[model samples]
Target: MSTPPASAGTGIAASRWRHLPVGALETVRGNLEDALLAGLLALPVTFAAAVLGGLVGEELMEPSGPATTLDLTSRASLAAVAVLAVLGVLARGLVIALRGVLMARALAAAVRAGTPPTEVPAPLQWQHAHERSDRAYRRTAIILLVILGLCFGVVVPAAVQEPFLSGLAIIVAGAAVLGLIALGIPLTGTVLRRRQLALLGPVDGHWTQAHRIIAAGHVLTGDAVAAARAGRPERGHPGSAARRLGKVATAVVGVGATAAYLGFQVVAALAFPDRQRWAGGLPGERADLGPEAERMVDLAVTVCVVGGAVAILALVVGALAGLAERTQEQAALRRALVEGAAPPPYPVLQRYLRRRSAPLLRMVSALVGVMLVVGGTLVVLDGVVDAPSWGSFAGAGQGLREATGLGPGILGLALGVAALEVALASLLEARERRLRDAVVQRWPVRPAPGG
Candidate 1:
């Protein structure tokens, strides 16, 4: 309704960077660049250490324990492994640090520029993570939808032919996702920059939907002040910054994770110095030494660890698989609409559906998580609670038969139950909301899209 003074926008942008003195932008950028460098430098070494990769960075000195002379004549190899483990630790620290630096830089930039940032607001961040939680709900909704056109939909069912290959597929799928993000990041930035001028918002925090374009413009400046006060999606502010940080963080984390694995191996090796050569149980050839129960326990631990890894990967897939479904189904709908077929249902339906399922779904998710933890804890407890006497469980070998087996079986069952719980709760919640709509006087319901 009125033309604001020219100084208004300038003041808003200035408020974004009160800490910025002379060349603060340059400083922020340099610090960010250095953090990125630290991340890159740390990656390979961290990964090597994590994987127990024998590629050594140092020579082994004599260890104080009996492990010093156990079977491996090469202390050199042992030292090399130790060095790798240390490297992994260092890399992990660097990665987290780098990610923080990236976040700070992006926040700083947004503050200076008076533009919004992209990270979902804290309130809705859960749903923004998309497929991160519910496998069953996504499966029920997306499977039927995605399957409508076999040509576009066959990949998922086709991949089920071999469960072993599914992990590799998940990893590959993750990589492709990264690739798409990489491709889109710059394009998104370009779109925002071009549209910057058309957008304008009051510098104050009071503006709502009527002020979105202005908020979008403020977000573009990467100005933290406007961003915090702004309501619209921060969109571009941290997107690029986050991308840079992720690479650094992943390398760092990979190293730490790999080092943990190696440490476990070394610990195991040390515990059973003659593990490969020594007969497992009944050292003196006693008749009562070996038992099937011991064997059962060992199997459990092995399964849990292996299953945990699978669960971790599945977690990633479960987290991302929703986004994939979102993207794929959205794409399919677009195609159908383009083909002049019965128009695909309103795209908003999918979003609302997800939004609506939010609470009950989250409850289910929490339920499942609790279940997994309880189950896994029980398994781990059983192993610790009753490890058979050394040399008693002859065929089972200490830990080889008992500890590993018992730990995982219980954990696996818990995970499955957890998954089921999240799905069922979501379904129930949706049903309850619909039935209670009249009685509740239209208590606001979340859409299935979450945000």
Candidate 2:
């Protein structure tokens, strides 16, 4: 081996990083701070929703019941709901923390294996794959947040005792707040990604050196590389219009189903015998109704069932399409890397790492599907079975119990799904980072520092 360079401090600097924690704590702290900021921004909207719910419940539903029963049921239901919410938050946090821990451990192992540290990007020199699917990811996230927020704002108030005008006002206000939040999410994510990439730094050398360095670092598992090798990347074709159209059908169906449901609600409200009656309503009980009212309710029940089914179907299909897209992207990246530089010939003994979060996406989808189905079933049963009024706290509690028992809490499922999507996005980001480092290392050309 050649003698070490003079100025020997460089050796010490490298050795220090060899034992470093690889910025795991920094990553978690940054993520938590971003999450806190997001929560703070959303706090006002959540508080407003809770206040409005309590006000409407006390004014209308409570007055219809014995005070003691109402108080007991309300408190019991709220407590149960709070407990479930806390559990869900804890579960999600645990998942994220565990993932970070594992990554840190792997990185530490890489350091111990003698992987050399790359030069970090100066603050102004940083560049990442923001131009890639990240833009689309952010946009889609924002759109989904806006759509769901509007739906909840409109639907929840209508479900309670809020007047039509009051519900409309809530929807407008919620949309405005969520719009700001939508913008914030992606910006925060971009900053975090940039910081992480800067810390990881760029590997620099020839293509062969790049490959060796990555292998030494263990940035990707062997199975991922092997799978990429076995799979053929999808190629664009002149006659692929039909396939492209098919891919988008899921989103279209989801949008259509949601629109149909909203339309049905509007039509039923307009056609009702007295619109004002809904403003102060009991869930299962109605005044002596004529045949027309009965028929309208039946029609609504039918629409809800069909619409919910379609929406769930759409989400399932969309999720599958997403997986396919990821697979294709991985194939393409793998092909590019292999063509540029060959990996080690010897087989690795490490167990294959399956994408754990992949199955979670399906689970969340199922939970959401079940929630929709249960809600539709309840409405249909109410229409056909002549049940007692469900507007009371006890009835509401019973409904909550049924819903929670059947599927995970709707809020929890939604949160889980969002987290999974974010995780998947991070995967794509990891791949991009590796590719960027490889390219820069091979070419020996760096982007000039700029803000």
Candidate 3:
């Protein structure tokens, strides 16, 4: 093999060895800050999980009837909730840990990119960076805590007391929180930028370029790290194939389970009219659904089933596509490394960072979509089946309320709230991606010499 150039070796040595301590320290500080933020972000989820777990636990332990045995559907619901609660707890911790690792890699790559080949960054420079990051993290955590406290402590409790208004209150509270976060991002970035300029004397475009290089390095490193963690198949690695197969199997199982649950609900609804009470209808009363109403119900159920299947299929396809993209990203990273060139700009990295809990977010979105479909279907059925019997607008309204009760009403409200959340998230993500792309273009990374 031909010997590498002296400058190339020196740069590698400096980044890998001489400046390793600075990078390591920065990584630790960043991870600590991120951990705090993660914990704060998890508070609402933890609360929800705890409440769900408690409810499910109580239901499971209580006697269902004279035989003390629960029906399969009741048992399934309780079990599913319990499992979700446990998974939520586990997923929280796993995400935090993964974020820590990602931060470590990003910080290391950033330190390497920011530091010149001839000089390691001064300890004071690292200290300044740490302070800026710490301040941002602390402010975010404080704001999140305050928002969560207010929503859960005051808003939720007050709303719960009013049976008629609780759903509305929950929706409003959720939207308010998402809106606040959306507003906070740009505001926080502006404040931090000003703070940076104040702390470090105004400099030429080089300073801005260096910051951009560091950011690009972070993004590239994060992509590489995430791709590596994805466990793509490697040549001569038989076990990698098995792992990839296992991942596919897991996805398939998840889709199947969701389909099974939805199918069970539909079958029960059609077969056991008395059990409609569980879905907020009156017990022991026949819906007396006419042929037209029955056809509508069938159509609604079929739509729900098909909609759910499509959602799951979309999720699976997305996952597979992501896996393939990650594999390509890894190859690109390797090529960039070998050729000493900057990787192509990847705007998705910005979106990925913003959506750290993407899997969870997607799941929730799917669930909300399902809820909307089911709830709307029930509302339509109520108006169709009962409105004719009641024979007047006022009577129809009362009949609709009595038939659907609080269940579908809450689901409908939740769907509305979720729509707001999705809109806000998309807007913020697009803005962030644009900002990141602008930064990358303005301060493009320089290619290394002697590639």
Candidate 4:
């Protein structure tokens, strides 16, 4: 092993990174400062929304009786929710902006000193996505703050504890809805003030798009490599037409997967709480039926839930695999022609790994959805069904109990279906990879000098 570098040299190098201290305390402090900045950017927007909401609202401060319930669910409350939603969007953008400043500055420093720029995962670098840590913390914090304010302060004092759940749910749901809008506002904010980077692809980060990258690569390659894209036919070819078909097919699968999952849920909603009675009335009322009848009811619910889950998983996996293939194909083409790099190998494990991640995320979202459904079911049942608490039995060990109870068996089936989706996703991924590799192997990046 080599000897360690001297302490004096280490100190000299460390001087630069001292700005972003590599310690736990530093992280806490950074988050605090970042959160503060994010809050300031969001608070004004939220306060304005609150003001607007109050204007149209029936009464900002009032005790609710039976008669006032309809008025409480008034237009003003909706307006206030809208305002909080906008504030959440601003806060998310601010968090990203702060982090981007830190990252860009760090890169600029290294570049000035003749060093490599700081690099991170492409997903984190994605300008539009909201799932990244930098964005999530900011987003969740803003929503949490709004919920606390309205629920604890306004709603509770007014003797309407319902606002706590209603506000929290509203914020969560609003954040999800605004995610798409937040992405677009950064593009060209006229009414929306954009203090963040444009919500485009990674091409915006290093300053410029694909064509510029192409020009730079050709120059760097000494004119040896020419550019080609997934679409737009190459100078000479029948194969180009064929390639478009594959690209189009990949896109179609993505759309289809999204559609199938939606359709399945709509159909499942029709099945109801039990075959005997449709939901919407007194759902929780206990039936005077025998144990055998309950058992049958449980079995039916499990079947539908599991079966629907399977369909969702298959569609999701298939869709993602298709997307991954198209992305990799375009990237490979770029690198092969522009940078003169050989196409990378697409081992089965890689495809499997890529597909497995999606199922995991889907599992997380599904877990949350299931918890809400189960908990809410239990709550509603307390009022009507007169059965054992379903929400009490959840988690890994509780799985079998849930199946026995019939409430959880549906979830299990869903999970089983998800597994099938993973398998299908893997298969589709492998096929897509092969298609790209075949095309890459045949396509000549550089033609011999004079034909």
Candidate 5:
């Protein structure tokens, strides 16, 4: 074999090194943007929860006493709820609209980059896949509805008075439902694959419309990355100014609501409750304010806590979305390099390898770190501080039990569940890496001179 020129080899190596950092930085920036967007989208949920908490707080502090039914007849309460509801709905709508705008921009960028159209499977095969997907969805929905009805409508209502029992029931039911869904996913995928193979003949490997769509998405994403790196500006659509204004307005509402919620929590904790009423008594045991005041306080605190939990969940989802995006990019680059097809830019390839080697390990490590930090913090706080009867932390456990029937045991259960998830994810990640390595090794690399 003839040796390539030294200059050519040097040029290739230089090109590979030149944009590697830029590409990786771009990937990280994209992930952060995705996470922030996801968190923004969840603001409405948090706002709604805050509003509910506020209403509950008002009822607790009401002069007439807590009503069995919400007093929607009260003008002040009704107006406040209505206003908050409208704001939440508007915020949600704007977020969705902004998402659409971003998607349009992405599509335009993909088109400008000359990304190829997605491949379409044969009509019969497509139809079969569609039918199978629909059937699976419907079946899953029905099972979910049945399980929810049994748990919430029957079991939960029966144990409503017993907070611990009801909370445990909810947790158990939720876990079982999640496990069922998880198991069903793989079984469904297997069935779909077998059916496809039977129809397309065993010689034809697994291919489906979903796979085609995913492949197309990867291509578009790759093109977008390339265009971004090349400094090509994405053309704005008509009404861009209006969309920008809408986004601004929505953001204002979301931020204002979130701040207001936090303020309420602070004020309610420090100034609202009468600490003297419950002095020398266990939290929620004294009826100094009213018979139902302590109960209402617990309910309000529970709602706020739940809202905080939801916010955290939203951020987690955003992080996952970013991870998924990076994974797709890595896969696209790997396949291209291995197949000797149109390989991505050298920088992108370098970026992929830099990311791919240790994502799962990093994720697992992060999870463990978080677990340790949280556990240690809780242990330290429990030992160092004696909780006041009227303090914010006071009656928190009772509040949780009142609201969800969950006791302190729920904390341990949550940690256990998280640990299990980390373990499972690590195993799956390892298996995936092994499979990808096998494929890469099997195929001879065909280097493309340029991206």
Candidate 6:
């Protein structure tokens, strides 16, 4: 083997290193004003949130009666709150910063493509689009990770220790966050898909070209196209005997799982003693688990209910996505056959659906991860901290230890949240793999090329 000259080798290595920072520098250069604004906005918010948190923590950790002076434990507790507040504010800042950067890049791309600012960016080649999409996916994921870290490490844990009314208030805040995430993820996905489709506009007029684009984009199978062309049934379609059976099996499995989970929920509810007079019947007639136990049960039920709701929502989304996919695939095949491989101008509806073939599971996973972090942190903090009055954080640590038996401890909450995230991630990943494999398997068994 011959080695390259030293100058040539050095130049190559140096070029690669130089390119590494170009993207970042470009982003910063494009969004310099927004970046500065983000920095400016972040400081005050961070300081305000942290200082407020510290003050709140000081009040919580104050002695039972009148206490003018702070103790060591109290000071430490205040510091924890301050740290969490800083994290939350910083997370928000990061979101602002990242959004600014994305917007700037998108604007630049649009200009380069000569598309109107109001209209979406034209879709790039599928390969290029896919690469950019992967990068976007990773960036979006990092933003979500930051949100989760803030929620789990700061907001929920810090806020949930308030009085009953305040606790409810914070829980509502957490729910609002979840709602935002659910809405945001789907909206982002729709925008991305629309942009991709817009990019494919030039090829829209030709059916043959569009067919190849769709196939190359992994939107439809060649076999499906062939079957459609010949006016025959597409093999392995849902209408097929095996697929129909599979559908039935899937429904049965889903129903069984739902029933089992419902049963478990019922059993859990019954197992917990009813303490409130309104809940059971008469005051003395209802058995009361100590106040702590009751609170713990309430927290557990809330977590379970929220988790269940998320699962149901995910299933609904998955079902809708699957239906949409099948419809699009059939429509693409139909258009291809009917048009006789006409050049360009693919059906707009079919093209839209085809371009959006990427799974929503990953985005949904990120949303769920954020929700779990917030919910789990809230539940754990509620169990551990008892902020009866202004300053009561000093005793919270002790309360946390005692409440361990009543509620799922901090460790258990963390573990449960982690497990849920893992399960959802694994399920989605497997689904994506199966889908890719099925598409790959759809290649024609025998080629009629150059015929």
TM-score of each: 0.22, 0.37, 0.31, 0.30, 0.29, 0.28
- 1-451 in candidate 5: lDDT tens per residue? 1111212332212111100011222233233333223323433443444345444544444533232112211212223333333333333333332222232233333334543223222222233223343233335444554654455456655565678877788767766755654454454456544544344431123333343444323322345436543643433222234334445544544454465467445435543554334533322322345546556555655545555455545444444544555565556545554554443443344333332323333344334333323333344334323535324333244432232222224436534654454455445444444433332222212222221
The global C-alpha lDDT for each of the candidates, from Candidate 1 onward, is: 0.33, 0.40, 0.40, 0.36, 0.39, 0.38
What is the clash tally of candidate 4? 7
Superposed model 2: Cα runs more than 4 Å off = 1-22, 25-234, 237-247, 270-289, 341-436, 439-451
Q: Quote the positional error of residue 308 for candidate 4 in Å.
A: 2.2
Tell me the lDDT of candidate 2.
0.40
Residue 251 lDDT (model 2) = 67
TM-score of model 4 (CA atoms): 0.30
lDDT of 4 by residue, 176-245 (tens): 6445444544432331122222332232443334422332232212122232232433433222333455
Position 37, candidate 6: lDDT: 31
Q: Best lDDT goes to which candidate?
A: 3
Worst 10 residues of 4 by lDDT: 13-22
Error of 3 at 49 (Å): 20
lDDT by residue (tens digit), candidate 3, 390-420? 3332322443345455446866685576655
Off by over 4 Å in 3: 1-75, 90-286, 346-451
Query: What are the per-residue Cα lDDT tens digits for candidate 1 across 219-323?
Result: 222143243335643333212333344445445445544544554344344333444544322123212314563343344334333433443343333434343
Q: If ranked by lDDT, best first, what sequence of candidates would result? A: 3, 2, 5, 6, 4, 1
lDDT of 2 by residue, 173-223 (tens): 766756654664555456544543442333222112433343334233445
Worst 10 residues of 1 by lDDT: 14-23
CA deviation > 4 Å runs, candidate 4: 1-98, 115-144, 147-150, 153-303, 319-451
Shift of residue 7 alpha carbon in model 4, Å: 42
**Which candidate has the top score in TM-score?**
2
In candidate 3, which residue pairs clash? none
